[model samples]
Target: MSEYRVLVVEDSPTMRQLIVFALKRIRNLQIEEAGDGVGGLKKLSAHKFDLVVTDINMPIMDGLKLVSLIRNDPQYKDVPVVVITTEGAIEDRDRALALGANEYITKPIQTARILEVAKKMLGV
Candidate 1:
């Protein structure tokens, strides 16, 4: 069986580490990390990922624009993007959904919930 690839885009090194740690706990999980949306886009374009977890606020580019780009690209249109961000506002959630995020979760994340969502989405 192939490992499930996950792209994690966040600005904070600590948060990124936390996410990486949580995801590593799952078996057959392969992770790639990016510091911002630009890096995320670069990675996305370079490789195929089964799932993406991105932050809303980032330098150079934001998660919304990155996700919109992903949705707009015919090649990557069907890829599932999960927004894990600090922006808990209703409008932000609506915007993310509109931009093609399959799911949204607030920051200070619960690792178990993250795992559950990942498992449900990835069917692993």
Candidate 2:
């Protein structure tokens, strides 16, 4: 079986735990957690990841900025990003998508939905 690495970026410990727990359901996945976008970028720099699941609102840096940075970097440009955020507004969703987020999921996320999206993005 092939192994995949995933980075989960969220400031809230509880929310991060929930996301991590949900992601653990997938087979052959090695997940990492980052409390904020700056940390996420550091992890991205240190290691390659198959996918990134992030929240829009965070201290220091936000998910949209992270997505934009990831998109701009040649090394990580093609990597898929899923933004799971409390920003449910259409403009927020549109901005995330425009910033190269492959998937944009609103907050109060369904674990099943995240799993489905992650599987599809990773081709697992």
Report every candidate's CA lDDT. 0.86, 0.91
lDDT, candidate 1, 36-82, per-residue tens: 99999889888889999888888899889988999999988888988
What C-alpha RMSD separates each model from the true structure? 1.4, 1.3
| Model 2 per-residue lDDT tens digits across residues 10-72 | 999998898888889999899989999999999999988999999988899999999999999
lDDT of 1 at 63: 87
Best by TM-score: 2
**Pairs clashing within candidate 1:** none
Candidate 2 ranges beyond 4 A from true positions: none
**Reference-based TM-score of each model:** 0.93, 0.95
